[model samples]
Target: MTEEQLDKLRLDGTKVRVVRDALELNDVVGFVVAWDDENVLIRRPNRRVVKLKRSYAIVPASEPRPDVLTEN
Candidate 1:
């Protein structure tokens, strides 16, 4: 994704999952922390930071789940 798009996600505090390949094990679920011309930084649920190259990163088309869920 472009820097602008990524920035929107970051600003909105959207949750995203990054998939590098078909393997489920390689998928990462987190929020976009920041991004530059080179890499995108994400913070996982465990508080671990991950950096992924912009060229290799793929953001899914689904809407992100809210940080907190509620039942009507």
Candidate 2:
């Protein structure tokens, strides 16, 4: 598969996978493990198990700025 395909797979809404980062939730933070077909297995910010699928999207965390600083 092409690199683009792989990236799409990672971001596809129907794709089943884990989010490799901890997230914040209402005063806590933790990582998301996997999606349980119906719900997402999130490692609760408080170190507990919680299922949630409120919102999720695969996108670059940061992008290069278009404007550059140059000195003459």
Candidate 3:
């Protein structure tokens, strides 16, 4: 994802589709991340470990992050 796209996700709390590694998908998680050039580091839900790019993943709009950390 691009910086602008990440920013938009942060602003609107929108869901984002990403390609991540399968090894990292051991648990259900939601995170807000700043995308880098080739990958991103997203903070896992409940303050869990942050996963780097692995395979493909999708995060919902209702997911929590530093900006929208509270559930509606």
* Prediction RMSDs, each to the true structure: 8.9, 11.3, 9.7
What value does the lDDT take at residue 32 in candidate 3?
53
lDDT of 3 by residue, 10-62 (tens): 67755443433334334345455566665565665556546566333445535
- Residue pairs in clash, model 1: none
TM-score of each: 0.76, 0.32, 0.45
Worst 10 residues of 3 by lDDT: 63-72
Model 3 lDDT vs. the true structure? 0.50
**Global lDDT of each candidate:** 0.73, 0.38, 0.50
Candidate 1, 1-72: lDDT as tens digits: 887788888888878887666555677788899888888888999999999887654564275432221311
Best-first order by TM-score: 1, 3, 2
Q: Which stretches of candidate 2 lie over 4 Å from their true place?
A: 1-28, 54-72
- Taking all chains together, the TM-score of candidate 1 against the true structure is 0.76
lDDT (Cα, tens digit) per residue for candidate 2, span 1-72 = 234533454455232323323432222223444554455554543567666553433222233222212311
Distance from true location, Cα of 35 in model 1, Å: 1.1
